[model samples]
Target: MSQFKIRGGKPLKGDIVPQGAKNEALQVICATLLTPEPVTISNLPDIVDVRKLIDLLAALGVKITPHSPNEYTFQADTIDIDYLYTDDFRRRGAALRGSVMIVGPLLARFGKGYIPKPGGDKIGRRRLDTHFDGFIKLGARLRGNPGENFYGVETHSPLQGTYMLLEEASVTGTANILMAAVLARGTTTIYHAACEPYIQQLCRMLNSMGARITGIGSNLLTIEGVTSLHGTTHRCLPDMIEVGSFIGLAAITGSDITIRNAGVPYLGQIPSVFRKLGITLHIIGDDIHIPPHDHYEIDTFMDGSIMTISDAPWPGFTPDLLSIVLVTATQARGSVLIHQKMFESRLFFVDKLIDMGAQIILCDPHRATVIGLDRRQPLRPATMSSPDIRAGVSLLIAALSADGTSIIQNIEQIDRGYQNIEHRLRLLGADIERIP
Candidate 1:
């Protein structure tokens, strides 16, 4: 495992451009498999997960050409359908949760899809029932063996689209179903579908590729099945999670930094959530500039009650940024509740912060109470292991603002989502080194 050695008490400066959206990249890359035409994708982050997915595509005989850094063109003209049943595919696919998305496109175009149980961050139970159920409703046969840890979906007859009201607004499930429905036989209506910016982007891209989709940016979607789809150029939105993380990093380190090309419109409720913690963000065109501050105080409610920040569906605070929010709250003047409604085990990383002298109470698996130090007393650095991707970055932010050198182990988790993070932080004048 890799480790980061960070010397604290340094304020970062200058401009940092957020990378491409990790979640969106996964969906769109899988969408490329829906068509045989060459698809060009720009502004992709060169992170571990994205690279792993690309390698998976290559392993399936998809021809990929590198145009430049952050740009690639993929042609899935001739795929090795047999590769889906191989041990190599199962081993690699199980390591990434995003790999499950491949099943949608493959089942749509090839009439069969197989996946070993997918793996991801150990935060909570993410069920695949929504995905398989959608396929079954669309006339596919499902077979799985829990003992063998394998799941398969196949259709001998052509799929006929039907109305599906999902039990939950699952992001990946929505993407998977949308991909499958685009090539199905008839019109499909999906109610309570996830309408996140990533999903909206996928809808737009699919439409550009000849799929008929309506009601974008809203939960209800109607798709008219198309005979075939062609290639299209897609540039992913700038990563909102990374943009929010940079905001937390600047607030924690008292740095003056500008996040360029931040895609401010897609960052719903995030800037306002951070504002509750007394961090000021100035939006200049498409950039967010954070000025240096001596201290930031958490805002109380209008009724003089303690503030609470919680995650919800789209246009709400994202669960992915709750860790950054929790870390940033450690230096504020007042107290607040950080409620993670989506994932259960994500809040356990607060113990590592408590060891560093932050006042945090882990109320349960899903909620935490934080009492701010108000920057009067700097945090004492401590060695810690990163529990997950978001927690890893939060710990790095904590280490950067601490009073002594800290070593963060298990940084492979961080690399899974972020691209050249240590190098980017170094460019911002942060005192961090990636030690092998």
Candidate 2:
């Protein structure tokens, strides 16, 4: 096991470039399966999840060529359909939740797909029914063997496009259906679809590859199926969640950092949400410049009610950054409510923050009330375990602002998403070391 030993109370200073978006990378990489021509991608994040997906694609016989540190070319000229049944497929497919997305593209290209039970963070009851149901709605037959713990999709005839109203605006579900719909025959209309930038990027990439899709950034989408798709080059946007985390880190640790190539146009409502927490950000060109602040005050409602930060769909606060928001609130001058509506178990990490001397009330599984310390009292350092990716980074931010040294185990969770995180933070003068 690997752990991080961090000494607190040091201000980080420098320009940090945000890595390519991980969520977008997952969707875009899987889109490569939709075409047999070469699909060249740049600005790919070098994270564990992406590496695993690339390995799985190779196992399925996709020709992958590395061009540079953050660029690759993939050509799925021929694929071994039978590889999906091997033990190697089961082990690798179960290692990452993103692996499930491969089924959609495979079903479109080869008329069949299979995957073992997918694994990811145990945040809540993340259901796969949306994906399976969407596939079935598009004329694919679904099969599952519970005794073997495997799921499969097949269709004798070409998928016939039809209208589908998604149960929820599930991100992965939308990506899967969109991939499957591209090769389907006839027209497909999707209502109440996810409008996140990731989805928009996938649509644009597919369109560039000759799939006709309308409604780029809205809930209603119209897709005209194409018999085949070609190849194209795509560069993903910067990781917005990482940008928000850096903003919170600067506020909590009194650091001044500039995040370059932040894709400011795509970061919807994030800067305003952080501004509500009294953090100062200067938008310099395409970068976000966060200055040092010893204290930040949480804004209350206009009627003197407590301020509440909640997550919603895109153009609202991101659920991924609620943990950072909760940690940033710990040092603010007033109290605020952190309401996580999407996932039930994400707020349980507050117990670890409370152990570090923050005043927090776990109202329930979905909400937490935080009373800030106003920087008068410093949080005491303690050893902790990372439960998930976002929580792991939240704990690291807390440790950097605490009184003494802290040890955090299970850092692999953080590495699965963030690339060389400790090394990146070290460039900004943070006192962090990784040990195995």
The CA lDDT of each predicted structure is 0.94, 0.93
Candidate 2: tens digits of C-alpha lDDT, residues 1-436 = 9999999988899999999999999999999999999999999999989999999999999999999867999999999899998999999999999999999999998999998988878788788888888899999999888677789899999999999999998889899999999999999998988999989999999999999999989999999999999999999989999999999999999998999989999999999999999999999889999999988998999999999999998767789999999999999999999999999999998999999999999999999999999999888898999999999999999999998999999999998889899999999999999999
- TM-scores, one per candidate: 0.99, 0.99
Candidate 1 lDDT, 293-409, residue by residue in tens = 789999999999999999998977899999999999999999999999999999999999999999999999999999999998888899999989999999999999998999999
The pairs that clash in candidate 1 are: none
Clashes in each model (backbone N, CA, C under 3 Å)? Answer: 0, 0
Model 1 CA deviation exceeding 4 Å by range? none
